[model samples]
Target: MLSKFYGEIFAILTSVCWAISALSFEIAGKKIGSLPMNLIRMSLALIFISIFSVFYNGNIIPQGANSEQLLYLVASGLVGFVIGDMLLFHSFVLIGARLGTLMMTMVAPISAIISWFALKEKMSLWQIFAMLVTIAGIFIVIYSRNKNHKKIEAKTKKASILFLGFLLAFGGAIGQAGGLVLSKKGVLNYDAFSASHIRIITGFLGYILIISFTRLWKKVFAGLKNTSALKTVSFGSFLGPFLGMSFSLIAVKNTSTGIAATLTSLAPVIIIIPAIFINKEKVSFLEILGAFIAVIGVALFFI
Candidate 1:
């Protein structure tokens, strides 16, 4: 019985891990800025993953990964880790982790759509409806109305910042969705942990290039000296890239990409209570309702 739902279980675990890491990254990013924090996070995560790979795969590097596998997995890393997470960490700085993670709920539907085209994955009409329902839930959380039902004005600088943050989050969703499809293609029948190592290796290299070209070594070095932020980033890296991402690959390998993605997208819902308590963010009733509705929509994928 447990074997049958292995993919789903791992995906749910991934959500929990991501929720914690999202809050950690948010706190750290605010202090060190997104770019430097990302480089450091990837670096720490690479160390953690390398150690795990040594124990599990008997090597620090992924063994037996062919050129085709390397191609797709490398693309997944560049898109998901380098591009997607860069945008996401910045969004967390501007919008807070709760709202930023809420926006990431879009990853489910986006991944499904991308998988359809890229991996020949098919979705039924019911699944399509579920996707729409998920989008509606996200819309409810992000958009607000006045007492008279008027839309909020975008004139304020705060509003503008929020808009940009949400846009960045959306771009992250697209990158992550594309990455999921590519990971599915690359990791079929491959060792999930080893596959994760490959993705992280590429992502680490990508960030190295980005930091070098942008000449952000000073910022990166500064981030290292901030003990508080460094602790947070290190913890987030352990939860995120080392564990959460490896579990996600296992999920996609074990089940349909759509289902796996939907389950993993539960981070928003999982993070709500922690966001309220740990992050000390005020949670409105509407936000709670919207999260539940979104979860309901995600649940429909199982049926």
Candidate 2:
């Protein structure tokens, strides 16, 4: 039974892995700054993925990938890892992982829309309605109302910060959506692990370039010395870029990208319990309802 839904199973697992990793990255990002944290985590993830490649692919680097595959995968790394994650990690620091990841539920709809244009993929009316529901749920969670059920004015510094954080999270969604589509294109009929390895390599090199041009090595060195942050980043690196990303590729390879992305977007719901207990966040009833509604919207895609 489970074997029949291998892609769905892995997509669920990817959500779990990503939920935990997002919390870890949030903690570390707050301490080390998002830029440094991203560089270091990518570096650590590269090592972890390389080690896995040795056992799985029998090589430390991806093997047998053609030029076209490499190009798409590399572009995915740049868009997803460099741009998307940069925005996401910063949002984590600003808004907390719970809300930041909640915002990421947008990835499913965004992926579906991108696929429609990029891959000539068609969506049913139900799927279109699903996307709207997903967006509406996200708005319910993020938007605020006053006592009279009126929209709150964003006239304060705190509101501005929250607005920026949500905006960045949305940008991250775009990056991830674009990357997922590109990954599906590149990883077709390819080994998921090796394909992930290629993406990570590109991400690592992309970060190196950014750090070099921006002269952020000092911050990177400082982050390295922060043992607490280092430990948190290391754990996140394993779960995130290594396991979570590889599992995502496996899901996309085995199933439709829309279905796989929708399943993985359950991270918002899965992260709620952890946010309440581990992070000690006070989740409101509306937030919970919004999450379920969003997930229901995503689930509609599977039908």
**All candidates' lDDT scores?**
0.82, 0.82
lDDT of 1 at 71: 92
Clashes of 1: 0
Residue pairs with colliding backbones in model 1 are none
The segments of candidate 2 whose C-alpha lies over 4 angstroms from its true place after superposition are 87-103, 123-153, 157-171, 294-303
Question: Mind giving the per-residue lDDT tens digits that candidate 2 earns over 1-303?
Answer: 666678878987998898899889879988987788888988999999999889886899899889999899999988988889778877876666556766776788789879888887776687578767766665565532121222232333387788898899999999999999999999987889999999999899988998898899999999999999999999999999899999999998876677678777666667777878877988888778877787787666555
Residue 149 accuracy (lDDT) in model 1: 25
Please count the clashing residue pairs in each candidate, in the order shown.
0, 0
On residues 48-117, what C-alpha lDDT tens digit does candidate 1 reach at each position?
9999878886898789988999899999999988898878877876765556666676787889878888
Instruction: Evaluate model 2: give its TM-score.
Output: 0.84
lDDT: worst 10-residue window of model 2:
144-153
